[model samples]
Target: MYNLGGSVYWNRKTFKKWFATRPINLKWMLLVILVFPMFAATWEMKKSSGFSPLQLLGLLVFAFAFMSIISKKTKAPNLFFLFYVFLFLLITNLLLVFFYEGSFSQFGDTIRTILPFLLFFYFRKHLNSVIDIEGFLITFLIASVFPISTLYYEILFNPIREVYNTASRGGGLRLSGFYADLFGYMSHLICGFICYCYFYIKYSKRKSKHFIFSNVGFLFVLLICLIGIYNLRHQASWAVSLILLSMFVYFIRKQVSAFQLFVFFIIALGVGGYFYTQIFETLFAKDIAVYEGGAKETAALNGRVYLWKKYYAFWENFNVLGQWIGAGFAQHEKSSVMMSGGMHNDYVRFFFSTGIIGILCYVSFLIYLIKKTLKTRIVEFKFLLLASVIVILMYSISALPLLASGALMYFVVAIASQINKNIV
Candidate 1:
């Protein structure tokens, strides 16, 4: 039944054994869950309903995942799960016709919200296979070609900013790549950075296979991750970068001498200060202008303070029930900011999209994750899980971390590891 994602041994009787119903192969499913969709961003040919490669890939994942729940066991839990996805698709289509006036953009918005949660839920349930850290990291790097290639394409081709999918802001061309916006691409870069550093750290400990971690190629990929994040240049990016750097340093604290560290920082300061204007101006260009206006609160947050005010007022207007349960996806998108996918805050996004009840569920799940993180004995797995949580919470303040697969996938992997002691 899980043939779609599980591996099958090949032999003379392979064809005869193909019909055997296998349990869900957790690792391959993780690969598919991690790889597709955003990878399809490199070839998004249409904005209309059902034409997008992402939409199609998302539908396939939803369908297969739900069906796996059904095929695994014919019980109340599985049936309810199957019905939920079907009902969502039905309501989404109906809402598109009436509430959204046939807007595929709204259709796209609704599906994106649903996919991430389903991906997490499915992985969390099938726990045994999530332990393949090395194999998964390799898969992640291979899948990264989709978004990373888009970065180089933009740099090499220099497409017209006016018409192409290129994202630009603050007089700088962002490395958004094939993603429709900067947040998604930047979020992926955050994941890439972790994977690259993981390989580098592993290789430095001892000699290893070329495919797992290459010394020369590792540096190249690491550089790309940093450069892409630098070009994207969001306030959230800076926060995430500092968090990542601090985490990395903390992990390798015992490996380096004080003199080595001092020299590293001195060289970094010298190189960065050498082109002070170019780097500083490019990074803080918009913030500088906003600060000059004397709007200290707004400047500090890049206008999120203002946006949050409006959202607060709008949310206040919700009735007792609406405030508790949320204004469904289609109804919530009536706000222009939401339709364009710019809440500038995940709490605000959650309030509008899922309301108090959903928020509680999310927060509770987070607590459970923290407990699991504490229980894990594996040092490396523990660090990855904790870091994923830190990244999500940090990005939550200024960006939509929940929506990014990069931010959520590792957490899902962490959950899988906690269930099995020997996964690594």
Candidate 2:
């Protein structure tokens, strides 16, 4: 404590020293800063074209991350080669922008897409220990509470007008929360649910009463997350959530007693059965009706099938090398002149924008990461990485998870990379 004008206070320098000395504090601070944009959504920012406060905060975090990487004298991990491939892809895209006469919008989009990968390397370089990773995850869980609260608040008191429109149009009200779109909101929830399951499993391994209570609390949070996903009414998100939860249970089944597993199955089945009707209605009925009505009927998948057909036909016009430069947003908008939305499929979008070479590079990078992750001794981290990869791959079939929620994707990758480094 230090005296300031006759008042006692915790000295700023003392606090700074304490924070810097503890690795966990630094990890938590980094994670909170990385996740800050998710919770700082505002109406004015949404309506305006300028950068939001959170984006500015993100830039500051990036600056801090760059400085940290430069100041540290640690050796680079073996996995650093992945960054070379990413940089190559970035350079290829930049070349396309230059050679293809791509607009500023295209250049901007490319930068946004690559920024998260750059940040991931910075995070992997800094968060080196198991305790640091755990602390970062806990900080992520804490940060998640803000968006979850906002989601429920919108559900309870401030339903957007589009909610009524969806109901009127014979569909569910898609929860957008503070996000600009439902997909972004659902992606954030997916990350939160994963963290909750991870912590629940971590605590359940301990036999102490406190750990048991914490496990029960985390279970409650998991249920709450399920409800939140259901409220979003996104079929892909629901499926991914169920898949991740199942993976978690299966992973921990060996650690639990037979009776405990039986009880869990019973609870899951009862809850699932209760929600079966709504789930079926939300996931299948609309699509089934559209299919039965033939070509005259409104296409299901929110016109995704139609958009894919159009984009695929357009893509055929390009040679085997495909469009070297990304088909800028302007081109996408022009292609969707008659339609209301985008291609929705990331593979299609990637092929159209970056061509077959980009796809090969991207797939190779994922395979490399998966191979590395599987070789790690940290079973829990491996399970989390594999589960996240599966969900992200599935999600990419319908939405561009990398382009839309790349930061979260890289956050998961960074954690896995650090875990693997620790093993070596």
Tell me the tens digit of each residue's lDDT in model 1 across 1-424: 1231243222225422331322444544655646663645644576554376655666676677666655554222222233243334333433433364446666666656655556554554554343244445545555666666776677678632322221213454555555666654664577767765554444334443454344346446556766776666565666676567556556544544576455435544543453354555555555665667744555446667777776767767766654665554334445434422477666677655555665665566566656766676644555566667777677778767656444244443433334323443
Model 1 residue 211 CA deviation in Å: 11
Q: For candidate 2, what is the lDDT?
A: 0.59
In candidate 2, position 18 carries an lDDT of 37
| Model 1 stretches with alpha carbons more than 4 Å out | 1-39, 42-44, 48-50, 72-108, 127-131, 156-169, 183-188, 202-204, 207-221, 255-282, 285-293, 296-300, 328-340, 357-361, 404-424
| Candidate 2 residue lDDT tens string, 307-384 | 677666765564444445334322334422211115666566555555556556666667876787678665567676
Per-candidate total of colliding backbone pairs? 0, 0
Query: What does candidate 1 score on TM?
Result: 0.70
- After superposing all C-alphas onto the true structure, candidate 2 shows an RMSD in angstroms of 7.0
Residue 280 lDDT in candidate 2? 59
- Kindly report which residue pairs in candidate 2 clash with one another: none
